[model samples]
Target: MKMIKTSMLTSVIFSFLWVSGGTALAEEPNLEAESAILVDAETGKIIYDDEIDVILPPASMTKIMTEYLVNEAVKSGKIAWDDEVKISDTVRELSLETNLSNVPLRQDETYTVKELYEAMAIYSANGATIALAEHVAGSEGEFVKLMNEKAKEIGMENYKFVNSTGLNNKSMDGQHPKGTKADEENMMSARATATLAYHLLKEYPETLETTSIRAKTFKEGTEDYIDMQNWNWMLPGSVFAYEGVDGLKTGYTDMAGNAFTGTAERDGMRFISVVMRTDSREARFKETAKLLDYGFDTFTYEKVIEKGESVKGKKALPVSKGKEDAVTVAAGHTLSVLVEKDQKEKMTPVVTLNKKYFNEDGELIAPLKKGQAVGLITIENDKDDEYLQEEMRENVKVPLVIQEDVEKAGWFSLSLRSIGGFFGEMWSGAASFVKELF
Candidate 1:
């Protein structure tokens, strides 16, 4: 089956490899889920979309925010991997609930931050999730604030977080954290979830290091050890394994059904996909695969511009009071966007100069250093392709820089040029006057 999938992707991408004129390869996928979206991980391009903004329960996928915060805390030096997190009454009680996904935690013992994180990441352990949340925020309630704050920061719309764990509050054994009510669960739109995952991967790429572990032994060498299995079936060696698939979260609940935020890389391209409320685990994975297939099959990753390449009519920036009238400029770096085979031509550069380097007349001041950042050039789609996140539009822009130095003109040189300019203007007026007289 894996071979078949690989074969199919190659055939589809190959047929359209040379396609031109911005022809889209196929219709958007008919995903069997309440909402879905597919995005280019690096370019933030919305390759496909469905009812992506409908808010719904995300089940264990809420742990994504938890994972992101833990990694962020470690990075910020606020926490340590070896930091010990003691089991709280709430965590211990939740761990004892056999009905939920978890590896039991002993009240008399404590675990390292890394151990609990792996359990939550790989096993969807509700208890471990709450433990890590408390460790980070002093309480799960405070963690929820951080979660929503981060949501707004990332531009997530139609999202809510009543608790750190995605479990329905009523099922928190009546121990739901403060500031929330019974029966409330974490909720997010498909777009919101994708946006969250996108930022998580981009900001904390080391997150993949943990999420990629298919199976691990929690508390490995002790009497409390439990072997935890990853819930993401699309992970390598799993039943629904897809090549290049790694490091993401999955979800399931009576209300949520089956949901997944999946990412995979092949060649130089990586794609992120979200499928919400599918009928079953199998359906979710299969739908996610279909979403990924569309990204890989339909879109081509082409370098639209090369570093230091000149754009038409943008070869240089005008200078004021300089030995040379202008300084040479070019793209500070190459810019690439995920484009349909034919859509490559439709992406155009929008260059906006940085005003700090310029005067009121919009000319660069003389004495500018070579390779100074002067502005940014963004690649915009002429076809009005809607990006999943507004920020994606901004991600494709490359910094613009000066290619050479333009020394300030000396006082004598300035005077000479001013006189030359005055004479040049007089000659232009004389020519016009002569033409009128004739």
Candidate 2:
């Protein structure tokens, strides 16, 4: 897979001018969010982006990492969902803080890891998040170290995590661990947040089972029962409920404004959108819906080449000192790329022969085997003669492989071919010089 920036409105504007001979460009969606991004869930392709790399506060969206680590622990057998965790005094006090979002827990009470995870995921409960972090790493400070490590491993650029709950030290009422300042808060760009969401869903898709719960009761049927609701409004029954929308998280704070990471599927195409620092809570979901709609309406995955199919107009490669004089090459796999509906006609595959397959004299070597990679096939958009103008846009790349084995010729045959090749080269050079003189 090749990583390339999605064709943004700016690029599209230029493309329109070049394609239509100076015609007016089409209008694009006007999003109200401060930062936004859309990505293909399966390929991590950025379909749209606006100020996506500008770092900003992430608020409770940070809990996604908290939930992710907990799931990792369970999968690794380090902990079980059914295991009981004793509520520490620090966690109980943090839960009681009036400024923080939390579900109250008794200091003497014990709750299952699964129960706490649900509270943290659905409600963005800071207390529950801290409790889980401590349970996983033995201390909030240690857990925070793990959070940064995981973020780095996931390829997150320009992000920082001061706490698992996403709260600045000011919101913690001076409860922050030593060496941490009061104003520090978790921060990440919208693009990095989307990247994190992609890996989180890819590795543990079952997390959707928890994030999709619209409403559920913790400690059901007991006097201690507390009802929790998912904060993400993109889910079903919400004001901006979108079809096929499911599991993800939402976040907000005075510094972070309103933020959300939403995922949806339709006709086998799944997408992830991240909107951060919107003016209002509703704007986050609204912008996300627009992004997803743009993606589904504008682009689609089209297969441009089939595996084992020979490249059109390409000749077989000459094989020196081989029983077979030449060998055919074909695509090793089906090549598919996401392209705009109208631009599909411009998509073309260009085959580039690998220099390593040839000898110093530019002749293909013998003993070539079937399925051995011999070249690269790059998918390019050539409408408006972009490729000829040196403005080529590459979407994806696949390998071209030899289609059959070419055994080396015997010693006697090799000697004869060498002599013939030398004479053939000399004659070709003399003919080229004579044509130039004429």
Candidate 3:
């Protein structure tokens, strides 16, 4: 392994402008939502945040988790999109509740998984979400367990789900499942909500097909055919439509207020924005647009290293006892960093070898295998004078691995190499002593 640091010029003009109050260094949009977050969908980098850590009721947004689990079950072959789902008494009762968002599921009728999914995604139907959950897990209680487990798996640390439909049990008018408390509702932070969206899109990108729909007819050509319209106004053709806004989920309740998790893509860059507890329905979409625009306008993804590419100055690593004297090394994977658009050219890379891989003599041990991680290559922007500080710098790290295998040398070869290494050390020490005398 080797260490290499590249120096680059900083954006002095921008720094001067910021210091002189010409413009703030980090200019963020003022959002009206109680809590909101915007994250890079591919990299999970936070572009803008306000009260993102505060936990609040997520309302219909809880369906996102239900949607995720249903997709997971379908992908894992536990269920199929065309599989028929029997509506239960509970689901039928939920559909009859005029106060809840539903598609009027019939107890005697059955629908395909895809139809139910469309209802949940497009209309935020509470009954449809519950039906899908019950079909996948056999019971809403069991499905709620799966939702919490999946949330933890997706890095949602501040989420709690009492029901799959995101409805407050009090609103159920005593029809809620047994053991569900009246005050129970899903609660999650804006940051966790954004994290969930990131994982959902990364794992199951096909969900965009459903979330992007502006309007569709479920169970078409049948007596039960119902017109479903997307609740997310940020989609194309909506009153507040924004270009590139395709997905995700929208939520509202008297208690939870209006909330939405929106995703959009432009020029190969995709972002997820979550707005929770906004004063009105339009505020959520408006604030989300501000977040998305801020991200795309300010930052861009920069590829720092390509997979299978060797780190500069790290062509080969010394081997103590092997078939050959040294073995080549290279980066194990591609590394990219999200930086301010103006700071792209100012980004620098620093590579450092892990000290454990080397001996006291600074030689790599023998018997190294290909793809073994021996060091790390970090990429950072030099625009900030405080680049050394981890908190203030935007950087990414990729593993540096041995590119080829180095087999152990025979006893005879090892002895010969040891002798040569001993003399080399002695000669280096003698030369240093002579230099000091001079």
Candidate 4:
């Protein structure tokens, strides 16, 4: 299969971006905020934000990252869900001293790794979280290292972790010998939270299945026989509760107020919203629902190209040493352009084929491969010409190739054909020469 030249491929892709528009959404006015952000989960576009870089304590919301690490390790076979873990003396005492969230583990009691994870994810159990951290990395401090590494990998620039649970006190350093102030246990900005949330949703789906549930009972053997409920109070689907909302976590502390990371999907589009330091749980719920509503109402998903659809305006490829005369190529994936409601009518996609397609004689040429991109399908705004020099945007390429192998005739047959072809060329050349002389 012949590879398409780089210049040709480059020309094709750049031409596709110009096809759309709207009154660009107004940028946010400069202002201080505790932290807030909205992002398109699929495209990773920041829709709105404030104070994204200002790191603040994430409270229990810190558990989101903890759960993410656990899920990834399990999925990668670094750890098994059913692997049993023995609780350390430190973990047992802390669970008693603090009225923190937990599944009520006894000293030295063992439970499968999966059970501990379920408690942490579903109940936001701080004790369960620390236990899992210890089990995975042999110490909470090391697990914090892995957490920071993961944060960097996910593009979180202004984040850090001091402990497995997010409840670290700014004064207490986790490394201090007992009774020390927890030193800013976990620090994250609204932007980082949204970024991490988006990555988790796109990369691992099983997490949502557990987070979305309202309640789950601990398996029969793990210490306390109590069933724990999710702390995310907005789940009931009330007035401010968004429709189609599912699979997320909630956080709150006296210092952080109500912090929530939420997700909702509708009409094939998904959005992630984070609100921090809201006045009350009710207010946090109300604002999250409103943000999701604004996103859905203002935009819609537009399918720009259907899979296997023929590229418009692209030239068909001339064949080389193939059975078929020429091959037709089309878009590999359904290319969709998302835009505001009113801009749909103004968009138009134009397809262009290569001009230097066939050889001098109108016969198929050699060595074509199917699925090779011969030309691109472009999209352009009809109105863009009014303001811009080039009114074209290319979207996707249509490929052309040999439909079937075109073998050269056998030696004897080719010899006969060559004589005829030679005679034809001679006669044509002589005619041209005579005309020129006259």
Give me the candidate number with maximum TM-score: 1
Error of 1 at 418 (Å): 1.2
Residue 389, candidate 2: Cα error in Å is: 26
Q: Show model 4 residue runs off by greater than 4 Å.
A: 1-33, 169-182, 219-223, 237-240, 315-326, 346-366, 373-438
The residue-level lDDT of candidate 2 at 291 comes to 88
lDDT of 3 at 375: 89
Off by over 4 Å in 2: 1-26, 97-99, 362-366, 382-395, 419-438
* lDDT by residue (tens digit), candidate 2, 334-421: 8877667656556788888889889887668999898999888876543322210121133366788989899999998988889999
Q: Provide the overall lDDT of each model, using Cα atoms, as 2-decimal numbers.
A: 0.87, 0.82, 0.83, 0.67
Off by over 4 Å in 3: 1-26, 352-356, 380-395, 421-438
Worst 10 residues of 4 by lDDT: 386-395
TM-score each candidate.
0.91, 0.82, 0.86, 0.72
Tell me model 2's lDDT, rounded to 2 decimals.
0.82
Which candidate has the highest lDDT of all?
1
Candidate 4 root-mean-square deviation in Å:
11.7
In candidate 3, what residue range of length 10 has the lowest lDDT sum?
A: 1-10
Clashes of each: 3, 0, 0, 31
lDDT of 1 by residue, 344-431 (tens): 7767787888888899999999998888889888775533766767657777788888898888999999999999999999999999
How displaced is residue 219 in candidate 2, in Å? 2.2
Give candidate 3's TM-score. Answer: 0.86
In what order do the candidates fall by TM-score, top score first?
1, 3, 2, 4
